[model samples]
Target: MNQDFVNNLYDIKGKVAIVTGATGALGKAAAWGFAYAGAKVMLTARTQSKLEALYDEMKAQGLECAYQIGDPIIESDVDHVVAATVKEFGGVDILLCAAGMNNPKPILEQPTEEWEAIMDANIKGTWLYCKKVGQVLKEQARGGKVILVSSTRGKLGMKNYTAYSPSKAAIDLMAKSLACEWGEYGINVNAIGPTVFRSDLTEWMFTDDTARTKFLTRIPIGRLGEPEDYVGVCNFLASSASNFITGTTIYVDGGYLAG
Candidate 1:
């Protein structure tokens, strides 16, 4: 393999990226990775303190990055973020929709309020980001990338995850729908479906040895996902390496779906 050519295929130098839900484990990891790859990454989340912390971390590493305040469901906030990013970094080349939530409760125990919360955070929020940022990408007319963070539960349902399962399942179509509409604009929309990853979100599930064991047993790779497990894929998806790829969900599971 020609090393230089291979590197060029994945190069993200001078690109601009916006990562929502960037304070979360996967989002933060992805933001850092993109910044490290020489892209100016803009991080967005509800918590300014967390965003600042991540900004400081990037600065210390001499990577190009910044953070902005945003709520996925709020159109004004999404507009603000896109405007702010364009003002600072020129335009968006990659949009990573990593903001999502899940409250695993059986259908009988799942209240309407919980279901709404899940939809608001995972579905509505993601679409807002995609729609707003997608417009920016389209105007640029330079082709762009959108990576939505999905989950294995979206593909294969599980008990006690009523709202979450359906919410993520929505992302599958959302990505495809956006891809079809935006393909002519040269914008690629795709998603990542990770399984049983250990993050702040999954901490409680892993705390119980029995529960953790049961989850791990499902992965043929015999391991749970770490934060690092997501970076390479996010980086690839955000870079030119995946230029021809769109409207597909890449499973980052440890062979969980295979089984």
Candidate 2:
């Protein structure tokens, strides 16, 4: 094969991507990554202010991207966002489900409300979006890509991370099931299992000396993950580069899981 042909495998130019948690740090990073890769992007989040800010920045950079307020767990909200994307960007060729939450507390200390919140945002939210978008992709019959955000907690048992861990674990399995079910339609589904990263939720781990050191000890890289760490994986999954890959979780953890 020619070298340019191989390089073009990773190209996502003109693709359309919908990022569910576009306002949050992780989602924002993924949105920018896709936009910068020459794809038109549609962003959704419960908060509109930050989403608008990101849209402005991307617009100023001459990238095609738009934002709308949406609650990923709401059925109507999912449908509305999908319609909005097709209306504004033509059609959805890729989806990055980054909308999620975590409430760190011991199992006994975790309230029923907190458990529900975690499950709703991390599991139900992702599922709702996947289901709606899956419908569109199936109808289009053009095939597509879906990348769900999971975390290291999904694979490990840790203190104060009970609700979060289980929710993420669910996301990974859901992605797998979707991958198998959607394979005939050419839709590739995968999950990104991130380790401790520097987002608002992870500020404590990076700022507190003791906590930082503790996490660093577990990571062979002796450092924490930054939001940018997700960009490459986001681009790869959204592009043709990973067309044959599906139903697996890629841990971008600086070797934290290995150690």
Candidate 3:
């Protein structure tokens, strides 16, 4: 292609990124990566302390960042985050929906409330954020990038991940459908399906010897994933490098799905 396109493909300087679930390990890693890439980042989560601490750390590193504390599952909170981002940074160039919950239960034993909770946080929350923030991108006439954090469970059937898997599966399809509808406006929608990673949510799995061994045995790569392992891919999908790419889910599973 053009030399200019190649040169600027991954250049995200001056862009504004909004990362939900900033309090979580994966989310924080994404936020920091964007900030380090010279993008002004807006962090969002339900915990004020964590958000503030992360924002402070980024600022200390001389990275441009701000934060808002709120629950992603709440519509008003989503609206406030978008509005605040617009007010402070003009508009958002990228959106990273990383807020999600997982409750492992066999299909037959899964509680109705737990199932609803997973769907609400993972599926509906993602849709709502895309709907509201996507409008701003469309109106501004600047194509934007949206990356939804899904899981390998979405691509493969897992035994006890009934609730979590389906919600993530919906997210993968949702990204595709949104890409189809929004492509004309220059908006790209994609997802990242990650395998086991060291995070607060998965600490319990690591603590159990049998569970850890079982999980590692499934990965052909012979190792588990870390949050940093996904940073590069997240950056690519959010930057100009992925301008022509959309409606797909990129697996960062380290061969977990291969076997």
Candidate 4:
């Protein structure tokens, strides 16, 4: 095949992407990655201030992006986000569920409320958005992409991660189930699993602490993951390049799971 033909497979210009948790580290990276790649991005988050700030920042960079304030776990809020995206961008071609939370604590010390919160945010929120967007995609019948964020925790057990790990595990399975269910419509559902990426949640690991050193040894690459490391994978999954791929978790860790 010609090289330009191969390159054009990744093109996503004019595609409309709805990104939840648009203010978070990985979410921000994904949103900017899509916007800069010529796709129009609609960002959704709970806080208007943070969402507006991110929107302004992207606007300054001449990126095409908009914001919608909605709590990911709320069903009605999710409905509104889908409706808003249709109104703003005319239609949706991609959905990125990036809103998630983690509360690391020993099993006994993990409060019921904390576990519920993590489940609600990471699992329920992702499912709700996927459900609504899946409807839209099916109706359009043009095939689309659904990208869910997972983590290595989904596959690997860790201390003080009882609640968080299970939540991510559910996300991974959800992606597979959705992929299989939507394959007939040409919708691709996949998850991106990252190992200890730089984010507000992982700020503690970035400091001069022993945990950082211990974690570093587990990763064969010998360093932590930065948000920028995610741009390529996001672009690939959100574009035609990933048309044949679905029902999989593409791990973007620095070879952490390899070892």
Candidate 5:
């Protein structure tokens, strides 16, 4: 391939990326990945200390980045984050909604409030960010990327994922619906569904135990995922390389979904 073609592929330099759930494991991975790839990143989350800490860490690396405090479920908070990103970075070219929660419990044991909380965090939060950030991309009239986080649970049913599974399933559809709705505006909306990644929530899966051993049997690759495994995929989705790809969940599950 020519140099121009090679350079254009996966090129995200100078683009502005807003990463929600900036304090979470995937959030940190995406934020740093984008920044390291030369995109100006705006980190947003509900916790100020964590936001500042992340911002500081990135700043120390000499990466162009800023932070905003916001809750994905709150409209005003989402609005401020969008506004703050534009103010800090001039304009947003990508959005990675990594803000989500999961409280796995049996259907009979799950409370209404807890279920609603999961919905609010995973579903509503994703919708709110897409709605607000989409407006900006529409106005700019520049094609943009929207990366929503889903899980393998979104497609496969798990015993105790009463609320979490449905919430993620909704996200998969939301990405498709938004992709169709915003295609006219040149905005690409897609979801990334990972299977049992190493994170604060899935840390126990890394231990040598029956649960870990049992789970490994399901993965064809015979391994758990790590935060680093996400960097390339996130970069692909955020960069111009994926301009024509949308409305689908790219499963980063080490062939678990293939089985």
Candidate 6:
């Protein structure tokens, strides 16, 4: 193998990527990163207006991108998004399962509906998207990449993280199982576990002094993560550089998990 080729393996030119929850802050950042790396990106979310906005923004930036509005929790919607992507882009090469929700509450106080919402949105949604995209990759007989966005809460326990924690934990494990089943089919499944990224979701946490201090104390880097912090890892995972890597979770948590 040529060393030069291996080093340049991170190039994702000409690949097609489908990103769920593209309307959200983190999701949009991930989609932009993929487009920046030369991949044709398909953004999916429940809100058509938001998706269209993002699509137009990316296009204005001279990026190859499209959008599909649908709920990932519905199998039909998932199928529709996959079909649309295939019809428009020819085939799928990468998937970013960034759709998820978080409702902070103590286990004892967490409502049943809250837990159900988190599980359905995070675990089931991610699984369905991967399943539909994985089938496309299998049919094409071409290996591809699947990247699940998880959290440090999945790896460690924390107060008021009841619903969110278990859902992300499921995501991390699902990536491993998917990798085991799809590696022979040329698919790579992995996850990125981030901690306290600056996003709309974390706005409340940052505003609360106690919450911010508690969250920051665990991180060795003593700072919160920015959306750009995850771009490099996302690019690496979606590229050939990670061809032989699967069934693992890379923490982009600013050393939060090290403690």
User: In model 5, which regions exceed 4 Å deviation?
Assistant: none
Evaluate model 3: give its TM-score.
0.96
Return the TM-score for each candidate structure: 0.96, 0.97, 0.96, 0.97, 0.98, 0.95
Candidate with top lDDT is: 4
Provide the lDDT at 184 for model 3.
Answer: 99
The per-residue C-alpha lDDT of model 1 at residue 137 equals: 86
lDDT value, residue 46 of candidate 4: 98
Per-residue error for 203 in candidate 1, Å, reads 2.5
RMSD of 5: 1.0
Off by over 4 Å in 4: none
lDDT of 4 by residue, 1-259 (tens): 8999897998999999999999999999999999999999999999999999999999999988888899999899999989999999999999999999987899898889989999999999999999999999999999999999999999999899998898999999999999999999999999999998888778999996899999888899899999999989999999888999999999999999998
Query: What lDDT does candidate 5 reach at residue 76?
Result: 95
- What would the per-residue lDDT of candidate 2 be over residues 88-203, giving only the tens digit for each residue? 98889999999988778888888999899999999999999889989999999999999999989999988898788989999889989999999999999999999888888779
Error of 4 at 29 (Å): 0.2
lDDT for each of the candidates? 0.90, 0.91, 0.91, 0.94, 0.93, 0.90
Q: Tens-digit lDDT track for model 3 on 1-259?
A: 8899889988899999999998887898899889998999999998888888898889999999888887888889999999999999999999999998888888899889989999999998899899999999999998999999999989888789888888999999999999999999999999999998889877888789888888888788887788899899989998878988999999999898888
Number of colliding residue pairs in each model: 0, 0, 0, 0, 0, 1
Q: Which ten residues in a row have the lowest lDDT in candidate 5?
A: 199-208
What TM-score would you give candidate 6 relative to the actual structure? Answer: 0.95
| Model 3, position 178: C-alpha lDDT score | 96
